[model samples]
Target: MTPAELGIGIVGLGSIGTTHARALRQVDGVEVRAVSGGAPGTAAECGWPGAVRLTPEDVLSHPGVDVVAVCSPTASHAALGAAAVEAGRHVVVEKPLATTVAEARRLAELQHERGRLVTMVAQRRYEPDYAYLKELAVGGRLGELRLATTHVHWLRDDAYYAAAPWRASMTGGGGSLMNQGVHNVDLLRWLCGPVEEVTAQYATLGHGIEAEDTTVATLRFASGALGLVSTSTATPPGAPATVALHTSAGAVELGQGEVLRWNLPGVPPPPPDEAVASGAADPAAIGVAGHARMWREVVAAIRSGGGHDADAVDAVETVRLLCAIYEAARSGARVRPGELR
Candidate 1:
């Protein structure tokens, strides 16, 4: 009700949407004023009982809504964000900002022209280990990055795919890399830089689904750093995902939320990090604390009349990379970035 408050309109009532609602509602001076997602009864049970349930358009056009959070599926993210941003509402997208580079770029330009706050949810950026790695990469503590390798192997049963129809297609979700491995995708790009080219192979593997369950790709960074990627949801008894960055000095390995290995001699790594719950095995298992922290940052950014970290323009690059990866795999050729337009 106060001028300091930000009324939020959240789209999608699935796990991530509920996660956002619960956390945003807890933040001071922020209200989950309205939501447009899931079925009415189901959405109500998730969170924000008092908030109005409206269609996405109505939610964005609503006067009380100061911001729109696109917690919807990957396919709906760009469309929802575009609508919200065009309506002059601040925006937040969950991940893969958009499926295509042009869509992401469009939102970025609109954000600039409209003078609105916009951010994408590459939540791993908020994770301590990844954040620390980012600091090292940016601060030159790890020296010039030569290569970054990642392995995101997880298991998802038939029922899991059945429950969420999106995971099985390119529309709602892309596949293992985009669905399960996207967080790591953002982290890799964030720690490394923009990717210039990618050569990849994608397959359905064992899952009875249309979307890919396994994929491998090699990346050429604009910074001249090359990287390797391996992702799948078919690995049995799935373990924590790992990313190893080989710099000129040494290598930095990141697991789930802990520093698996940090052997840079000149720059001493921090103390051992306690293992943190990674929503790797279970999407809903990731604690709401991270969302709470992100919301606080968003609220601050809004009040400051600026934008949050990983704004659409910044985060759109990640989506562009995702597109490149998929394209490379589909064509069985080395694909260059920005070629997905």
Candidate 2:
């Protein structure tokens, strides 16, 4: 390996971990140095036959591992990410940060104290359409935001839950909101600004899971914009998740991969980027373009001492928003994300 090449060790070689490994192929100067926690020979099975399979602990301590990608279950994200940082490795964690706001906050604090680069996997932020949308919204091209909404109406069969018991438990960060809906939540919050309060209701309408399969919430953004969020694994024949932005100037809407509507009069919409893919109907169908883009940019940032698009600290806030929604549902009262921790 070249001296400048960065070494990556991945924990949890499941679909997500394997996804990370494959995404790294599009990144330059990075190689899978070690991995642990999945079916035996996952590294080879994922096409990285050269990567050594090791214990989770061994992967963290591997001399070649300059960075650790914590693709494990959501419940393990905080602990593994913290341990990796403590081991003097930059870390990457999947979304929602942790099962609770407290854990997410603690992990963020530890990352700061350790002075390591930690990024959360909210890959949708890297999508060409989504990225351009953010640019336009933040640039004020969308005019003063009046309302922003997102819906992640997707389905998960019993087999999906059976394949991973943890996915059905709250402690494991299961449920549609956290597991499948977080990326949309992240996008919603990113576009609409901080949420001042939330009122929500949730129920387990499908798949006898321990966590709610459906949740609906109304948000009040600090910008005085009203927002709506609906997520469900109970919905049949899932379709692409969508987000719409309404402003004084006009309105715009985008599905997971395609633009649904672009009403801004003088502002032309972004050119269609055919590379986008969605896991609306089938989780396995999620494309790697977003992950690959994120990996490339993150590696470049690490090399140049620049900042990453998805900061661990910001991701913690996203978790706080989710926590607030759940709290509102349980208490039947408006909850503020800022007041979470």
lDDT of 2 by residue, 11-74 (tens): 9898888888888877888989899977777787766788988988999999999889998888
Cα lDDT of model 1 by residue, 163-250, tens digit: 8788899777759998888878887888888888999998998788999999999999988999998889888877788889998898
Between which residue pairs do clashes occur in model 1?
none
Error of 2 at 219 (Å): 0.3
TM-scores of all candidate predictions against the true structure: 0.93, 0.97
How many Å off is the CA of 295 in candidate 2?
Answer: 0.8
Candidate 1: Cα lDDT at 10: 85
The candidate scoring highest on TM-score is 2
What lDDT, from 0 to 1, does candidate 2 have? Answer: 0.88
lDDT of 2 at 205: 97
